[model samples]
Target chain A: MLFVFGHQNPDTDAIASALVYASYLTRTGTPALAYRIGEMNFETPFVLQAAGIEAPPRLPELAEGTAVALVDHNETGQSVSNLAQLNVTHVVDHHKLGDLQTNTPAMLRFEPVGSCGTILLRLYREANLSVEPLEAQLMLSAILSDTLHFRSPTTTEADREAVEFLASVAGIDDVASYAMQMFAAKSDLGDTPAEQILAMDYKEFTFGEGDDAQRWGLGVTETTNPGYVLGRQDELLAAMRRLKDKEGLAGVMLSVVDILEEHNETLVASEQEAAVVLGAFGVQTEASRASLGGMISRKKQLVPALEAYFEQQG
Target chain B: MLFVFGHQNPDTDAIASALVYASYLTRTGTPALAYRIGEMNFETPFVLQAAGIEAPPRLPELAEGTAVALVDHNETGQSVSNLAQLNVTHVVDHHKLGDLQTNTPAMLRFEPVGSCGTILLRLYREANLSVEPLEAQLMLSAILSDTLHFRSPTTTEADREAVEFLASVAGIDDVASYAMQMFAAKSDLGDTPAEQILAMDYKEFTFGEGDDAQRWGLGVTETTNPGYVLGRQDELLAAMRRLKDKEGLAGVMLSVVDILEEHNETLVASEQEAAVVLGAFGVQTEASRASLGGMISRKKQLVPALEAYFEQQG
Candidate 1:
């Protein structure tokens, strides 16, 4: 039996790749169990609905015979421990190398591209796996989510090639319309409970020193398009503060990435962190700032750079 | 010589697709000039930098011997005179069909998708174009932007498919990471001018019955994660009023498509238009009370319904 594993607090990319990977594995004669760390979020539901696959219920078994594959995130102490109780054997990720990669004996695979969905897309392509339209759509949605719908800097040529290939094979005439609808659906962020908002789309990280062992969970807070973003600015900041306090995070940062500026509206951990680390890289923390405006993707934009800062401190 | 044409004051989908389309055309052995309609925005700069290409200066000879390609919005009778003067041969778009299509006869291609970028990707593939890594990235970015980063309800299986195929070919491994960064980069909306915010990512439409013109624009006033769209309730109504005053429109309208719950936040000309048309179809002005909360796309989600409503009215 094979199992598919993804990071805790899964995003659309994790959900998408996990679903596609499980499908691929199933196609290859493996009854795979797809596992995620936490409960599913709103962003994950559509892909699951589109794929017509039930989320894998928590498994009661993980033994030595179980070969596991990690999608979207690499395996480590911090990685979702779906197979740790059993025995995971392989890791596939598209993010930059994580420190956990050094200690893991699993098939360490990390490619610095945009989405793990793309990684799984390559796997499917390499193995000549047949792609269903819904599965193709799921994989495509994952890529869109991961790459900020393909605006992130980390999205590479391989990502686009996957898009082109998948577009043709799926016989999709126009993807943008479909994707925009999906985005509009996903950004339905109103009247939701704070907890739901917090968990709706989140990424988790274990930062700080060995003794610190602080788990950081940061969720995005967006504003109204332009002028109204000014109105919601204070409310969003307050919400972020509440989340920060509730989570007891080392630093609760929220940014509003303006696609126009190519700069970050930085809400940093401290004035010192912003000045010393983020400022070193030119993230603006001006007083008149609306919010953290220029940081779009939390993974590629914030985590990686913040990881670098902590690494430098280490 | 190939010319990239975009409407004046381009949106994210238009400009980003133009940049990426330029790259696609270049890879297909057609050197393209990324002509700008106006100043670039955050999404454009990020896409340009990520694609490793720069938007070039407009060529004075766009009217002569130019294998002119138009993206996003198309030209109309009211369109800039230069468009009619151009040696235009091809057009790709994602908006509702406009007067420009019937009024003009350049290889008109309008796919009622969310973004024009998705159509451009199709053109590249249809032409058997060889794409570069940066080109793939740009194309994918354009797709995402048009799709509201894939949350919009109008998102099709095809859009997702293209993103996956292009991402893989472009070698974008972790699409989420890149997307997060880009999204984070856009989080700042504090310092943005009100007019700039209004125009930042707005779409305009002009539709008059016979002689007079009834024009309006719809802008996504707010968004966050997965199904929470707090539309700028009052402002959008005001903007519609302003458009009515400025254009002497028979009736101006503004719609906020909540893609998550699959409804619309509409501001129309009269209670006659609203009740006789919108109310019957369940479109309400009470956005916050909208039981249908997930209407996230304007092009695909809102336009068709409006067209149907108008047809029903007739």
Candidate 2:
């Protein structure tokens, strides 16, 4: 059986795209199962429940002989465990490529769109298959989540078109209102512990390996108001410190972005990371928190800026 | 105009594939020009002269606004100079990938075939376009040369089928006799100058840059009999030293392989490289030269063995 999956710490786009792609393959006479590398996050479960669709199974270790297709990610570190051992037949991704080498020539459909679900939407259209309402809703939720309700710089014209088309198919009259409801659900971390809050949207990036490796983490939390996170600074700081020590990372950056205001209030977990953030953002900082205006995208802005800083330092 | 070219040091496959692809694009109503990054080598001229096809234009400087498609090679250092400035529309290559990142998404058709011409052959069949007799001859010659008459380990079933089909189209009754004639023409390098002989089939492989970079040169000369090259060892050595000094390479290796016997006699220019070659091939050496039996294919055996050695050292 073909197991289709995405990157670890599965986001809405990764999980939804795998489900949609696996469904497409199944309908086209291929027996495939959709899987998630990690458990569903806070917002993803809400989206799946609203659409009346079951969550994909969490993937365990796969055998070397099993065939697989990748969605949303192409990096081996982010993909399923022991990715090189399995047969990778295809890659359908939207992110920048990493050091992914297949043993044989595989079909690669990599586009610079906002979400991998957008590519799946195009595939459905090309195959002349009518998408179910639940599938449409899942894809639409993926697009809204990844593009940050059209605020992300990663959003493209293709994403906009796909979002509109999927909205119509799902019978959603007001796209913006639905997106705000989903964002509010994601932002409602009132009773959740600080560690859970930090781990909700956490991601790690590593360059090199072993003693020469440089690794860092970024935890992004999107809220309607930034003060919600800044007010609980002490609790967040303790959790961030615990995570840094546990992971033995170079540093950690927690971004509390006001989605509506299109601004950011970043909390640096260590002095080393504070220096990097200062070099990257040139923003005002007092203690661990910094007030940075008009920087929303972690992919387009933060990661690239930090990578440039490290490359220069080297 | 769409400028189609290959890597520096244009081999038979590189030159012939560019010509074939340019012709296909032109026939399909695109204004394209075939260009070469380097001067023609010894065996390539014979292929073109026999087909009665003129050599492609030598590329000088390209404007930033120009459109280009790469074939055969994709590494930035080996590709056309100032590649980042031009708009790379497409890439069709058969080699392992390098650090190639385009500003925009480009059409990439990377196959693990024996030659770039083999990919072009599949493209022609997919488009249902009948190739001309001269073009068929050029492609057939390219496959034979790159796969070493199906002796190289990189040869696939697709290459074999393409060779037979192209042979039929080119009105060749005996494929083996034609391949031997081409090999004999390449092996007949007695009258050529030593410097020219070294430069004829030379290639450079590099990893990283600056002080951290490791750069090496490989000169492969195929002969029907081994004595033709072994007898002129002194002249070859002097020429190899001159090339090493001119190219600023870390080390240079000269491989004189007898095609009929499928054996390689490699000469190292330095002690450091001699140690590496000894470690890689496990062959005893007096001075810089060593005899390695059944190691003719540079792509499949020699380069991979040397790269493994360097990686282990790191």
Candidate 3:
């Protein structure tokens, strides 16, 4: 059986896309099982409950050379620990291409749309397979979560069309109200520890080449109430510093994204990270925070800017 | 304007898929012009002549950051010289994933099929676009040439289905006869220089990482008249040696594929190459040549085996 999964720090899209794609593959005559590499974030539980589905089981320890299918993510740094040892048979992703390779040619479907859910919808249509109600609901939630209800810069016409089609199939009306409710569920962080919050939607990326190459951790917390996240800035920064040391990362930053306003206020763990962020975004760091207006999408806006800055520096 | 093209040392699939995909993009409201980064191989001319379509113009010098779309290939070493500088907005390929990075998200469609033509056929269908006669003819020829008329190990069910559908749309009935004619045309090498033959359908690849990394050049010449090619083994080996020296490659091998027999007999340029091939394929080299039985596919068979051997070596 092929194991289908997504990136670490499982967000709603990461978890939902894996489950939907696994089901699509199974329906198309390939036996596949969905797995999650990391713990689900606050938003994922809400999305799963709304769709009346359970989260996929955590990925078990598979022997090297196991066949796997990747959904919603492709970068090695964001995937399984034994990724290089496994056989990646298929990849359906929406982010920029990264350094993931296979021993042979594989099925890879990627588009510059808002979410992997949009691509999966096209895949189902092309195969002449009807999307089950559960699959449709899961995909609909992923699209809304990833695109922030058509507010993210990553949003495209395909994503909007997919959401409309999926909403009808999912028997969902009042998408705005549903999205707000989802955001509220995500924003109700309660008393979650700072370390868990910092790891909720985090990913690591390598920039530059050779000796100049540096690995940095980037985390984002999207919520309707950004104030709730920013209020615990010191604790988050402390956790970030601990993570940076534990992982030997060059730098780390946690961005508090206001889902309604579609803007970012990032907290830098140290002066080194603050300098890198300032250089990359041209924003001044004040009291360990930088306001990045309208830069809400991490994949579309933030990572690209940081990558470009590092390339220029090199 | 998006300049769509394929890999260097363009083959039938490379040149034809670029033209067909460029047309697909244009029909879908994106202005695109097809170009070829290198000279067309022998079979490509025959395919284009049969389709009564002109070959795409040679790629001209474009400024850095010009938007481009890649088809059939994506590795930087096999692509245009300014691949890293240009903005790659789209890629449709059927090869293993390589080290191609973009600043932002792009439209990437890849499948483990025989040719990019098969993927392009699906793209057209998914978009509800009709395939023109010329496009159908080009894609049909590409599938035939790349899969060696369904005899190549790389051939998949999708490729066969695509050929049947395309042959009907292209108004071509005797596909077997046409494929033979193409092979005959490609085999009519006459007095072409050994260097030119070696350069046609050649690609460079890097294996391993960091201090252990090694770059190698691989070339293939597919023809019905293998005796004719093997008869000039000395000349071909000399050309390969010159290429390795000039390009600073660690090793070089030219595989002469017998189209009818469906086998590969490779000529190693030096003892170093012979050793690598022997270790990788466990085939003894006799007089600078090693017969790789039923191993006609470089992408599917040769490269993967060689990559695995090198990875194990590290």
Candidate 4:
């Protein structure tokens, strides 16, 4: 059976797109199983709970020679651990291509759309395949999450169109109300472990390979209050240090974002990385922490600045 | 009107896909013009000639606020020089994303197929649109060129399927025979200027930005006999020096590839870049040139090694 999965950290878009694409492949005569490489985050579980669907099976490992398909992400660094060993048959993603490549030519469906769910919805329409109500709700939740209820800069006319069509099919009249509910669901993290919270939305970038590889990981935690994470400063620092050591990373940073306040306070775990972050974002550092106002999108704002910083170092 | 074009050093796939996508957009109510950013390459012109069509108009400079759509490439460095100012509404390409970003959301249709022509063919079929015999021939030729008639490692099953469908529509029974004829057409470059011939299939990679920017250009000239290019070593070296000076490039290398022999001999223009080329490809140099056995693909073989070299340098 062909296994379909998304990136690590398992965002709502990642989960929903894997389900949708796996279903599409199976319906089109390919036997496939949807899986998740990591644990579901707070928002993704909310999507599943709202849709009353079972979570896709968590993939611990894949046997050698098993064919796999990737959705929502193409970065091998953020994908399965043994990604190079798997026979990647197809990749359906809406992100930029990373270092991922295949031994053979895989069917690649990469777009710069806001969400992979949007692409899957387009595929359903193109194939004249009708999605069930639950499927529509899953796709709608994914689009809403990735676009921040159409508030993000990444949202496009196609995403808005997909949301409208899926909303109608899923019998949702007030998308704003549903989005508020989802946002409210994401607000609770009082008792969660600091490491789990950090791991909820972590990404890594490796500049080199082999003996000269330099990797850095960035974790983002979005909530209604940044104070929640700030209160656990000691625990968060310990968690970041542990992750850096465990992953053999060059550095680590955690960006605690206040979604309602539209601000982010990043805490750098190392002095060298703190310099890089301060130079990149042009912010003042107070004890390895800096405030960035109105900077939300990681792919659009944060990644580019960080990339520029590293590139300029050369 | 939307002006659509591809990267510099226009190839058959770039030219044909721009034409096909522009036609699709126009038929679907959006008026569009297909353009090429650079002068036509040898093989691209042959494809247009065989299809009995005139080459697309060359784009010099687009006015500010002009809406543009990019095909075949998405790198701002490789695209129109004034790309940052244009309102990019769409991007349909099969290559890796470069540092191109739009201020507004674009309807991007990027795939990792062998050729952008393959994606355009799929678009035509999905829209229930009919392509003329000449259009089919143009797309067929593009697929053949990009995939090297199914010999390149980038060729996917989707490309093969598209090729079969397009060949039938174009009334060609023997694809091998047609490919041989096209290859024969490409074998003769008797009296072309060394600089012009080198610019025919050139690519650029810019690492940093602003004062710290590092830019390098790579050119590939595939021929049945590399002896012809080797005989003009002085002229080629002068051409490379002129290009490096005019473009303000950090370095430039021209790879003379023998298609039948499946080998490449890269000529370095400067001593600094010569060391880089020698170290990156791990080959012995004769003066300022090195022979790489069985290395034909710039994308698959040369680029990755160069990237590794640059990354390792940091």
Best by DockQ: 3
Interface RMSD of each: 23.8, 4.0, 0.8, 5.6
For all predicted structures, in order, the TM-scores are: 0.44, 0.68, 0.96, 0.66
Q: Candidate 4 residues B1-314, lDDT tens each?
A: 99989888888888998888888899877899899988876677777887888999988587886998889887777888888778888888777555565543346666667898888887888778898788789889989988778766677898999999999999989998887677666757789898898799999976434565578989988776688888888899899999999999988989987766767898888887778877788777777788877777787778767766876675
Please report how far candidate 3 places residue B152 from its true position, in Å: 0.5
> Interface RMSD, candidate 1?
23.8
Q: Scored by Cα lDDT, where does model 1 land? A: 0.57
- List model 1 lDDT by residue over B38-102, tens digit each: 65555566666776766655535444334577777654532345664455555566553333322
Superior by TM-score: candidate 2 or candidate 4: 2
Q: Give a tens-digit lDDT track for model 3, residues B3-59.
A: 999999998999999999999999999999999999887888888888888889999
What is the fnat score of candidate 4?
A: 0.10
Local distance difference test values of all predictions, in order: 0.57, 0.81, 0.91, 0.81
Error of 3 at B314 (Å): 3.7
Please list the residue runs of candidate 4 whose C-alpha ends up more than 4 Å from where it truly belongs after superposition. A207-214, A245-248, A270-274, B1-15, B21-47, B50-52, B56-116, B125-137, B140-314
Write out the backbone clash pairs for model 4: none
What does candidate 3's lDDT look like per residue over A1-314, in tens digits? Answer: 99999999988898999999999999999999999999998888988888888889999998988999999988898898889989999999998888888777889888889999999999999999998889998999999999999999989999999989998898888888988988899899999999999999898988887899999999999989998899999999999999999999998999999999888999998999888888999999999999988999888788889988999999
